[model samples]
Target chain A: MEQILANGVYLGAQYAMIALGLTLIFALMNVLNFAHGQMYVLGGFVTYTFYGQLGFPFVAGLVMSCVTLFILGALIERFLFAPVIRRSSRDESTMLLAAGLAFFFDAVILLLFGEKQRGVPKIVNGVFNWDFRLIMPYDRILICVLAILSIVSFILFMQYSKTGRALRALAQDRTAAQLMGVNVDRYSMIGFALGAMLAGLVGGLLVTITGVNLGMGGPTSIKAFMMVMIGGAGVISGAIAGGIILGFLEAIGLAVLSQYGDITYLMIFVSLMIFLAIRPQGLMGKPWG
Target chain B: MKRRVVLKSAVAAVALSAFAAGGAWAENPVLKIGFVGVTSGPAAAWGISNQRSMETRAAWINETGGYTIGDTTYDIEIVSFDDQKDPKRAIAGMEKMAQEGIHYVVGPNVDDGAAAVRPVAEANGIMYFPYAFPKELYTAPASNAVLGMVANYQSGPAIYKYLMENKGVKTVAFIAANESDPLSQRDGGVAAAKELGLEVVSDNVTYQVDTTDFTPVLTPVLRTRPDLLVLSGVSPANAPQLIRSARELGYQGLISTETAQDAQVLQEGAGDLANGFISVGGASTPELASDAMREFVKRYTDMFGEYNDESNTKVYALEYILETLKANPAAIDDVNAFQATMDGFEAPNPYMVGDAKLRYVGSTSFGQKRQVAVPLVVNVYQDGAFETLFVAEVD
Candidate 1:
């Protein structure tokens, strides 16, 4: 049971990080941002190149991954998303554009890095012997701590800061916030960059544990999207709740099912169906106002 | 004017005929070797190694003025198509090679890819050399196909024998991919373990091919506290990850696998954790290899920047193939004659193990002799390097 919970916490922290990014994007821009996962992968590769390949300091690589991906996200918003979002078929064009960007990013990484699986050296190697039956790895502890800190910091910012409040107001009521002199365009860019930076940071951190592969972005996107939908598509708190729920469920399923651990997907889908049937707006999502 | 025109015409006709004759006489007979395998996806390492090794081998042969048979010398060339580890893509790649009149073919390293391309190669009467270990590939519709390495059945017993004897392994926790090749591997291990008086603590653990996190499966296996963990016929792509996960979870038991050939990749994945892991094939150290194999390994690594899995086997097989070509030059045009030459051929072993001869396992069910019985050695990664231990002949 402790082992199962350990796995759940490890997996859930990653899910929460990814889902938070997705929710932040949706909250700010009302775009699904399909390319979000690709940004995550790009960040991983960047860290792999810097720390794993170039032999830089691990913390430097981590910082560079966030800064580089944040800048990239802002540039993408400025040049690609902004132009596409203004067109008559804004939603359709933006979705198509994001998908295209995802493919482009995957192809670029494939060309640059080749198809081999790359591993980043763990920041903290080996387990810390607790003398108990349960063994705890330092990496897992670091992951949980970092995830909680990021979440709390973001929440605190949204509650207190002028920019964060404006972004929250925009998420709640775009027209009213605009009438009250909130710059929607600038907030959208900032929100996308923040979301992308979070994804990048998680990717860099998780690559040490999961390893990085060219095809990882697709799976990461699918899981994060699943979490977002389960948590209520645009709900911040819902994403966290949804991620933890899915993570624990998957861990428990794998523990019990053993070889047939693939059945976790079916379980998750069934739970999603039941949840939708019971409450259409997700666990914490507001109904269409 | 008529006399001059006739003189020019006669000169042009003679030049044309002479040019035609020269073209025919100077046309060097070429031996085309085709490799169809996964070169573009997650399992790209396997196919890439195949390509790089074969290319190096061919380049070495070509540099020596090619293989001579009768009064003809043929330039050796390798043409490869990437299948991406997909069955349909493998078949398409095989078909493409066949269309290009390539008679000699090698690889689709995975079982399904081999299964997909085997029929196409056989139908086209191509000389197929497969590294995959599925029994179905060696069974029906096998025309000029030869198993280049030890099959699952052959390696399993050898692997377990080494563990039970050399490593003093008493109990094993077995995990294999739930597929035909691996299932066969599991059977071999079980039979060998039983015969050798070894215990299987948990014999029924299997994982899907795409499973990345092995903690869930290893959690239960580690509880049994077996002396050895057997990951037979698992993809090379997954073996390192699984081994690393087991280590991360504090399972200190010895990990052994038959399908892991590339120690470099495993080391990269597991870092210091890869120590004490056992795998089949590969020279334990540079000193264990023959002079020829040492040179080949040096050249291969210097060129590609990585050590290939079973470098000795690849070089030996290529040399054997070259010798077979020398014995039957006409085999190029007639694949049956080529098959017969390979079937009847014998040579001294060119690997680290002495007294082991290059031979074949003639299957009565397959109705023809295919599959070369190369020397099977058990290797362990100790102190961040591979150390070769026991050497056994493939029966």
Candidate 2:
């Protein structure tokens, strides 16, 4: 039970970090940001180059990932999203653009990084075993703590900072925020960049453990969607709750269903479907089109 | 009168140039071979290795005045398609090869891709050597796909017997990626292990191919305390993570797989934790590698900026195709003729030093000469390289 809990907590922390960025972008831009996962992959490669290849300190590599993704996000929002959203009439048009961007990022990543599985040296070593009941690696524990810290930092920033206040108002009501002199274009760009930075931060952190590849982008986005759906799309608290819930369910399912074999994931998916059928709005989401 | 003289002089010039070259032909013809497989996604290494090996050998042969069969010396050209690991795309790739009028091809590296392209290969009279291991692909009523490497069943029993006799292994466990290819391999490994009189303590453990953290998936298998853990049909990308997870879980038993792995990947992904890991490797070891094999590796490295160990096995498919065509030039355009030639086909293996021979086997396993008879070279991962564990033959 202890081992399962530890696994759940660790998995939840990382999953929540991944969902946070996707949810943030959706809330700010009202665009699904399908390339969010590719942005995450770009972050991982940046860190892989800086830390794994260039012998930089791990912290520096992580910071570099954030800075790089942040700039990229701002540029993408200004050049790609803003122009398309302006000219397009239908919401699905943005979805198409987002999907196209996903393919573009996938191609760019494959060209730049190649298809080899890459990893970094463990930042810390040794196992954290408590009588074989609650076993965890120190690297995992450090990453979990760091992810939680980053999440808290993000919440504080959104709650207190002037830019964060402006972004929240924009997300709440774009026209009202614009009338209030929030600089809609600039604040929207900042919010998108912030969201992308979170993705980069998680990607940079998890690259040490899971490592990243071009193929991971699609699945990561899908998993992030599951979390958002479970918690409620475009809701930050919903994303975190959804992440933790899915994480615990996977941990428990794997632990209990070992005797039954590969059907654990199938059973989990079925249960989720049943839950969604009963409550389509998810745990905390309001009805939306 | 002037036009007639010009034409006469042009004909004489052609004849004189051909006669001067001491040949009856103007220039050599080109034989195009096709490669269809994943060379872009996560599993890119597998097909990339296959494509690179073919390209390297083709370059070498072309550089050395082309390959002569019967009355003609022909240039080797590789036509490749990146299926991106999708079966539907693999079918399209096969169709493209047929459209190009290629008779012999290599690849579609995974099980589904191989299986998917079979009908196209048969209908189009194209012979494809695939790196997949489903027995039905080589059995009766199916003839186009030739097994490119040693199957898990063959390597599994061999490893199990060696361990049971030498390392005292009694109980074993199996884990796979929950995909069709790996699951099929797990079943084969399970059967092979059982036939060898070893107990399969656990065999149902599986994880998604995209799984990053394997602790949850491996914990129950570890609890069973099997002496041997077989990762069935594992890809190069996922092998090290599984090994690292098992070791970090304090598994003191032996870990093995039945697929070629990249040493650099293992080193990067698992570091020292990958030491003592066992796997089926490319058919040649350092001791077994001929000078030609060494040169091929050097050229492959030079051409691609790096070399993949899997290419050691991949290098043989195109050679087999060309040599078989040379044996009976009729097979160049007729695949049925190629199938007829297989039962009695024999050639000297160029990759090895000694009296190693290249031919088709699988009469015992599949009741046909539908498998490549490459020497099975078992490898154990050490610091940053795969040291030879043992070498065996498939009969």
Candidate 3:
């Protein structure tokens, strides 16, 4: 049980980091950024380029990845999302636009990088002995700490910082906040850049554990959508709570039913269905305003 | 004077035409061969290396006055494609090759690539050679166009038999990727273990291709407390993660697999965790003392600047095909004649396993015995490098 918990915590941290970006984007733009996963994949490629190709330090590579993805996210919002949101046709238009952008980005990435998983150098090496006969890697622990820090810092930023508060107001009521002289367009772009940066950070962390491949972006995007839906769409706290719960459930479920052939996906789907039936608005979630 | 001038001009034109025809006939025919692989992914190392090795061998053949078929010598020209390890791409590549009239082609290295190209090759009457071990290729109703250089499903049983006899392994757990190819290889391993009277404790497969977090899978396998851990069809990316994770989890059990045996795989992918793992392959390490092996290695490194892999079985088989065709040019004209020549032909094991014989089993399937030998090289990772433990003929 302890072993399962240790594993679950590590896996859950990664999910939380990835989902935080999706949730943040949702709050700011009122549009689900499906292309969030492509940003994650791009983050991994940037890390690979800096560390593997340029021979930079692992941490430096990670920072470069974050910065690059932040700029890319801002650019995406400026060109792609801004035009669609300006028209304000319907919610479906936003979703369709986001989905189209996601496909386009993924296709571009595939064309450039080809379909291969590339490995990044491990940042930290060594194992941690928790108790008698229980050992885990320090990298996983670092990831958990980083996830916690990012989430806390994000919450604090939204509550205290001037720009973050403006972003939140814009998220809550775009038209009302705009009338109050909060630059709605600028905040929306900032929100996307922030979300992309967070997602990129998670990608860099994930590279320490697994390889970065072109196929990863699609799955990451799907998981992020599931996390956001489970946490209640556009709810900040809900995304975090939902991410952690889903991550833990997946990890523990995989551990328990490891003997069964090809049951992981089925188990996760069934669990999600049950959760949806039990709490329509999610565990810690309220209906979207 | 006008008639004389016209006759002279006509004679000059005829002479020019005759010279052109002579030049065309004199120049060696470029025999086009196709090579297919996933030239773009994490598994790119294997694909790249396979291409390099084939090119090296082709260069060597061309340099030696090319392949002699009867009175004609043909220059070998390889047409390579990046299949990306996608079955659709593989099929498309094979179809393109067939349309372009390539008679002999090598590769589509993995099982899925082979599966894609096999039917197309059979339908088009084009010969295809692949370097993956999947039992289904050998067991099914055979086709004439496909030839698999690696040993068949029987090799797994041979491996298990050897382990039970030598290593004293009683209980084993199988870890494999949850894909069709890996699943098939795992099934073969499981069947072999069962036949050898060994206890199979657990079989775990990961659905995700880039699974780094193996604790969910490995913890349960470790709990079973098996003496040996068998990995089936592990890709280059996942092999290191599994090894590292297992090591981190303090699994001291003997690890063995054929998939992670490539030298490049160990150096680039596995790193330190690769130490002490054992794997099987179709070729032995090149001995510097042997002129052929040394020259081949040197030329390969000179051309490509590194050892792409140590699998010389494909190269040797390819060379064997050339040699067979040379000895009997009539065989080149017909598939049956070619198979007959391949079956009858024997050469000194180019892989240098000692008295190992190469004979093509007459099967139409691409994996059919192009060459017959129990040429399995067992390599152990020692002192941060792969060293051959034993080269036994697995019957």
Candidate 4:
């Protein structure tokens, strides 16, 4: 049981990282960026090239991955999403566009990297043990700590910072904020960029844990969607709770059921249905207007 | 009237010349051989290795004016399809090959893909040389199927004996990916371990092929504290991750595997952690090479920049096919005769990997004539190189 919980906690940490970024985008944009997972994949590949292949410092690789995604995400918002945002059914159109971009990213990565799995070497090695049992790796511990710290920092910034306040104002009421002298376009682009940067940081963390492969994008995107939905769409705190729930369910299920661990997805879907039937607003989310 | 007669005669002469030219074209033809496998997915390395061997050999043969059968010689044209390691895609590739009238095929490397592809090839009367380890795919229903690689039945026992006698391994824990070949390997491995008097302390553990974190699977097995861990038929992409995870979890047991034949991948993925790991593959180093093997390694390295064990096996397959065709020319036109010839065929070249001569054998599960009894080499990774510890001869 201890082993299961330890593994579950680690899995939960990674899921929360991905879910946090995805939820932020939904909260600010009101658009489900289906390409969010592809951003994660691209970020990991960038880290792999920088730290794994080019022999750069791991911290440098992570920072560079964040910066690259920030710029790229801003450019995508400006060129692709800007013109489409004026439409009446912008949400559906943007979602479709995100899906198309996801496939396009996969194709481009496949062309460049070929379809082999690439790994980022562990920054720190060795295991921590309790007597003859309960062995946990230091790298996994580092992942959890880093993820929590990053999430908390982002939340604090959103609460206190001026730019973050502007972003939150736009998320709360875009038209009203615009009327009150908030630059709607700049805040929207920055919000998307911030979300992309978070996704990229999570990618760098995970590449060392699971290794990076091209096919990771599709499954990961689906998992992100599940996390967001289960937590209530457009709710940051809900995303965290939902991610941990799903992660623990998977890890504990695998520990007990072994080969039938995939049934956890079905269980999560059932839970989603129950949540919708009862408290559709989710644990930390307000009821939809 | 005289001018009209001359013109008619000239027209008839030109028509006669065209007919004669068409008749000459019928004497020599291009023989289309198809290769279907996972050429562009996570398992792409396996398919790419086979592709390198087939394409390199085909190029050499073409350069030398092709394979000669009696008085006529035919150029071998290789048509490749990437199945992406999926069964449905493999079947689709087979359908496409059938439409194109390709008579010979190289592989559908994975067991599930092989199962789907075999029937299609059999139904189309195309002779297929598969790289899979499954038994039933080579049976009566799929008479055209020929296994060019070693099966788990032979490898499982061979590995067990090596670990027991050579390494003095007494207890083992078995793990496999949840795929046709890996599952079959686990079944074979467990039975072999029991037969060899080695106690299996842990139950057979299985994980999905795409499983990233093996902690959930490996944690319980580590608690058993078995003397050895056997990863049977794990994909090349997953093996290193599982191995690293096991080591990191503080399981100080001897590790053995029967998959991921590429040494470069093992080294790159697991780093120094892979040292002392026992597996069933080796590079074509100088000492292990015969004259022909040396030539093959040199040519292959020149063409592709590196030589791995899969490259050698696939090359052996191409050699076997070419030699078989040269000996029995009629088999080129008649796939039934080709299948019969392959059923009883022995290695005509000095391709020494196993003990004695390499040949096809019958299986009770498949209940038909199939599978080559290739030598299973017990290789140990030490000091960044694979050293052959033992060669289990096939009887």
Candidate 5:
């Protein structure tokens, strides 16, 4: 039980970080950024090249990932999404654009990174075996701590900062924010860039543990989407809650359902469907607070 | 005027002959071979090795005066498709090959892709060598899908028997990814372990292919404490993670897999933790690799920036296809003729140190000559490379 809890906490921390970024983008733009996972993968590759290949400090690599993704997000919003959202009548237009970007990123990742699975040297070594009850690697524990710290920082920023306040105002009511003299166009781009930065931060932190691959992009996006849906489509707290819940479910299901084998994932999916059927709006879909 | 007319007539005759010669040169035939497999995505290494091997060999053949089959010399051209590991896409890849008029091809590397292309291959008179091990694929009803490399069923028993006799392996556990190819391999490995009188401690554990954390997945399997742990049909991407997880969980037993693996992937993913892992690999062991094999590796490394050791086994599929075609040229456009030729086809294995013969043999498992008889070279991972352990063969 202790081991399962530890495992769940670790998984939940990282998963929540991933969900936070996706939900943030959706909240700001109503775009449901399908390319969020690819952004995460690109962030991982950036770190891999910087730290693993070029022998830079790991922290430097992570900061580079965040900066690179932030700029990319800003440009994409400024040049692509912003114009499309203005010209189009339906939100599905944004969805189509997001989907197209996902494919475009997939091709770019393949062309640039090739198809080989890549991994970095362990940041920390040795296992923390607690009386044979809880066996977690030191590296995993460090990553979990880092992930939690990032999430906490994000929450604090969203609560206190002026930019965060403006972004929140925009997310709350775009027309009202525009009427109140907020630069709607600029904050929308910043919001998207900030969301992308968070994805990169988490991607950098987790790359040491799970490694990165081109194929991981689509599945990562799918998993992130599930977390958003569980939390409530455009709710930040809901996304975090959804991520943690899904993480624990996986840890527990894998631990308990060892006897039943392949049906573990099947059971998890079935439960998700049941929950969705019961509460169509999800756990935190009602409001931002 | 008479002198001018004669000179013009002679010049016209020379120009017409030059044109005729140029037309003859342009008419030289190109024999097209096809490869349909996953060349991108996580499992890309598997199919990439297969495609690169075919391309490398084709280029070698074409550069050195081309290949001759039944007195007609033809340049070999490899046409490839990236099925992206999808069954429907693999079917489409095969149809594309048929449309291109390629009669012989290599790959569709995994079981699902291999099985999916069988009907298309048969209908189009295309003979394909797939690196999959479904007995039904090689049985009487299916004849076009030749087993490209040693199957898990064949390699599993060979590996288990060797471990039992040499390392005193008395008990075993099996874990597999929850997919068709891996599940099939796990079942086969379990049966082989049981047949060898080894106690099967645990065999039903499976994890999703996309699983990032394998600790919880390995915890229960490690608790069983078997002497040997077989990772069934593991891909290059997952192998190192599984090894690292098992080791971290304090599994002290021998770890082995029937699938060929990339040494670089293992080294990068698990580092020193992967040291002692055993797998079936290409015949690239220093003791077994001949000068021809060394040159091929050099060429491969030159062509691609790095080399995947799995190509050791993959290089033979194209060789077998070409060799069989050479033995009976009538088989080039008639896959039925190719089937008829398989029973008696034999040639000297060019890449091995011994007087080994290249042939088709699967009578023991499929009651037909439906598998390439490459020397099954088992490899043990140490440091950053795979060293040859023992070599075996399947009938």
Candidate 6:
């Protein structure tokens, strides 16, 4: 039972880190950036290039990955999403466009990186002894710390920063916020960029824990999407709640039922379905669509 | 009337010259050989190495004035394609090669890729010289044209029996990737255990392809308290994880895997946990101190700069194929007849594990050899490196 909890907590931190960016983007833009997962994978590859190939420091690689993706997000918003939003397409079309972009980026990644699973050098290599019997990797503890710091920093930004206020306003009512002299377009671009940066941060963290490959992004994106739906899409607190709950469920369920059969993925889906059917507004009373 | 005569004469002249060129080209009769494997993706290293080895052998054959059949010497050309480890791509690659008029082909190095190419090779009457473990391709609803140069999965059972009888391992457990192409072959080890009257305590299957976390699977097996654990997988990455996780969960027993990749990398990853692990493969370690083996290793390392896990086996096998062709060139014109000659030919190839002699079984479906006595070496991780425990011939 302790082992399951330890595994769950480790996995949960990674999941929350990944979903944090998605939640930020949806909260501000009311646009689900389906290409988020591809961006995460791109960040991982960039880290690999910086750290593995160029022999840069691990921390520098993480920062470089975040900054690079931030710029990419800004460019994408200006060139792609900006025009689409201006044209006023149906929501379905918008969703399809985002999904198409996700696939396009995935293929591009495959072409660029090939399909090799690249391992990252460990940043902190030692097991943490937790009183008597429990032991875990110190690196996993670092991940949890990073997640908490990120969530706190995000909360602080929203509460105090002027730009953050403008983002919140836009999320609440884009038209009213535009009337109130907020630069909606610029803020939306910034929001997307921030979201992408967060995702990149998560990607770097992930490589330290799990090796990165081309196929990792899709399943990760689905998990993040599930987190978003369960936590309430636009609610930041809900994202954290959803991530932790899902992580715990996965850990506990795998511990109990793994011997019987491979029911880990099935259990996750069943939980999501039950949650959606029972509470249409999600955990936070925030409607997803 | 004069102009019309001129035009008719010109047309006749063109037709006559075209026919003459066609006849000249037709008299040459070019035979094409196709090579297919995962030339890209994570597992591409294996495929690329196999292709290079095949090319090297082909170049050597062609350099020696080509393969002579009867009174004629026809040059051998290898037509190669990248399967990328996808089944659909494997089929497409086979069809494309077939369409390009290749009658003989080599590879589909791994099992899944071989499975994909098998039906296509059979349909086109193309001889597929697969690099997968022997039994995988030959044991099924057999195709005479498909030949495998590697040792069979039954090799595992042979190794296990030797270990149990000699090394005193009494209890065994089988753990394999659920989706691995050779997952069924784990049964070979299981059956061998049963035959030897060694306790077969558990059979556990983990998810295939990308298994990052093996803890959930290993925990149960450790609880069962088997004296020895056998892992069936290709890479060191998976093997180390299983070994490390097993150790973390407080299980101390002998651990063994099939490939040298696991033996080397698992030690690096798991440190002491990888100690005492033994595995079997087609190639002997370079440290064996045999003159022929030493020379082979030296040439390989000199050419490629490092000893690749399976490259020696593949490269030498290709050389064996060329040597066979040289000895019996007449067999080239008629594949079936050539196969017969290969069956009858018996010269020990030092490239195989045990200075093993190769002979073709009369059964065409079974390829060139029904069995080759590749020597299996038992290695233990000692003082941070793999040390040979025992070397024995596994027939």
Number of the predicted model whose DockQ against the real structure is largest: 5
Compared with the true structure, what per-residue lDDT tens digits does model 4 show for residues B61-134?
A: 77677778666697777889989889999999988889998777888888888888877887887777887876
A-chain TM-score per prediction? Answer: 0.94, 0.97, 0.93, 0.94, 0.97, 0.94
First chain TM-score, candidate 5: 0.97
lDDT of 5 at B163: 94
Instruction: Pick the winner on DockQ between candidates 3 and 5.
Output: 5
lDDT of 5 by residue, A1-289 (tens): 9999998999898899999989888888898898998999999989988988899999999999999999999999999999999999798999999999988988898767766777788899999999879999999999999998988888899999999899889988999999998899999999999889988888888778888878787788888988887889878899899899889988998899988986777987798899889987779886432
Candidate 2, residues A91-141, lDDT tens digits: the string is 888898989999999888876776678777888889888988877889989
lDDT for each residue of candidate 3 in B76-140, tens digit (9 for 90 to 100): 87788889778899999899888888756677777888877878877776666666665455444
Best by lDDT: 2
Per-model i-RMS: 2.8, 1.4, 3.5, 2.8, 1.1, 4.0
lDDT of 2 by residue, B1-395 (tens): 99999999999999988798756323678899999998875677888889999999999998899999889899888999999889999999999999999989898899999999999999999999999888888898998988888988888889989999989999999999888889999999899999999999999988878788888889999999999999988888788888888888889899999999989888878889999999999988899999999999999988877788999999999989998999999998999999999999999999999988889999888998999999999999999899999999885
State the lDDT of candidate 1 residue by residue for B1-395, as single tens digits: 99999999999999999999778545566778888876654566667677777888787767777767779887677889988677899899899988999887778777777877877887897777777766666765656667777665666677777667767889987877656567668777777777778888887767655455666767777778899888877766677788887887778888887764566656666778878888776432465565656667777877666566755565544555666666787776678888778667776655544554565664652546677666666788866567776766654
- DockQ for every model comes to 0.28, 0.48, 0.27, 0.30, 0.57, 0.19
Alpha-carbon lDDT, every model = 0.75, 0.89, 0.72, 0.77, 0.88, 0.68
Which 10 consecutive residues of model 6 chain A have the lowest summed lDDT?
Answer: A113-122
How much TM-score does chain B earn in each model?
A: 0.84, 0.92, 0.84, 0.86, 0.92, 0.76
Model 2 Cα displacement at B184 (Å)? 1.3
Q: How many angstroms is residue A99 displaced in model 1 relative to the true structure, after the best TM-score fit?
A: 5.6
User: Which ranges of candidate 2 are over 4 A from the true structure?
Assistant: B1-29, B62-66
Task: List model 3 lDDT by residue over A24-128, tens digit each.
Answer: 888888778878888898888888778866889988988998999899889989987888888886888888888887778666765565444566556678888
Docking quality tier of candidate 5?
Answer: medium
| Docking quality class, candidate 6 | incorrect
Residue A249, candidate 5: Cα error in Å is 0.1
| DockQ, candidate 2, vs. native dimer | 0.48
